[model samples]
Target: MKILLDTCVWGGVCKELEVAGHDVVWAGDWPEDPGDEEMLAHAYAEGRILITLDKDFGELAIVRGIQHCGILRLVKFAARQQASVCLHVLTRYGRELQTGAIITAEPGRLRIRRPDEKGQPLTCDIQGQGSRCELRRDGAGTYRLLPFNRGSSARQTASAWGTGMWEGIKGAGSAPGSTAPGGETND
Candidate 1:
């Protein structure tokens, strides 16, 4: 695969991808920053997947409707983990990358955004741990993160997480935290 690593990505990632037999370009190596839009354009023109830590590319692609081969946004990952995670993502979602899907890879989740046949953006979230846990808004307007047991029902897993964990979703607490298990806090 051909990849364009954004300036924010660790330079070591380029070497790792190269060792994995991928054609890699690190934007950090450039003499000057051509800016995000130009970088995105260059990646699109070259048919390379743009790998970045920036969220702006998603807005540019989804809101501005810019054309691109694909985008993989790695969020909150440490520099040492970037290369392995990048390879893992490529091994798993290479097809999506080839077809222009915007994928956000986070701690233990992957949020995939792609346009439907009608050009409407559709999102699919997959937990990197294996199974999926969906965040849904209830009729009462509260958000619940529903975890599922592999062979069982969603209700079964709810009890495993317990009510306190669920209650944490209601509003901001005295301290910043997460409702998801092993998840990162926003602040």
Candidate 2:
């Protein structure tokens, strides 16, 4: 799996994935902050999954129509915690993510919307129109993020994250990169 990691994905996860050998690149390696739009564009153009910690990309993907081959947004976790969740997602669900999916990881729960899965697929009739889905971890089932906030006068907030199982990803996780992916070619 080729992944373009956001600045929020710090060293521990970076090292873990790098050692796992998944061809990962960092946003900070760019000449400057590539910004969400440009960063996402780079990932899409290169067929890489854009993994971000900032949830703003979720909003941008819908409102600005940014498309990415795949995306993983790690919500509300510290650097180490984020890394653990990412490792689990990549190790346990890497194959599931290959086909243009929007995956959100929030501690114990993970939610994703793949191109042809089933209920509530992102309406991406063409390429470069990203798949969109953000889910809150609910007991026994998943819940959408936007609909839960839309009816309120004040915006609702999701809870903070927890640490995850990190046993296997150390041995093999999706790391993806060589040249700085922001400007250089993915190869």
**Against the true structure, whose TM-score is highest?**
1
lDDT of 1 by residue, 1-187 (tens): 9999999999999999999999999999999989989999999999999999999998898889888889999999999999999999898777767889787887765655554322322222345345565444467633345554434544555455435424222121112233344454422
User: For candidate 2, lDDT tens digit of each residue in 1-187?
Assistant: 7888987777567777777788888887777987888888888888887888887876676556677677788877887786667777787557656766677776433556664544433211011112122333346433223322232221221111111211111111111122211232111
Instruction: Show model 2 residue runs off by greater than 4 Å.
Output: 116-187
RMSD to the hidden true structure, all candidates = 8.2, 16.3
Model 1: residues with Cα > 4 Å off, grouped in runs: 117-149, 153-187
Candidate no. 1 TM-score: 0.68
> What C-alpha lDDT values do all the predictions have?
0.71, 0.56
Query: Candidate 2 lDDT (Cα, whole model)?
Result: 0.56
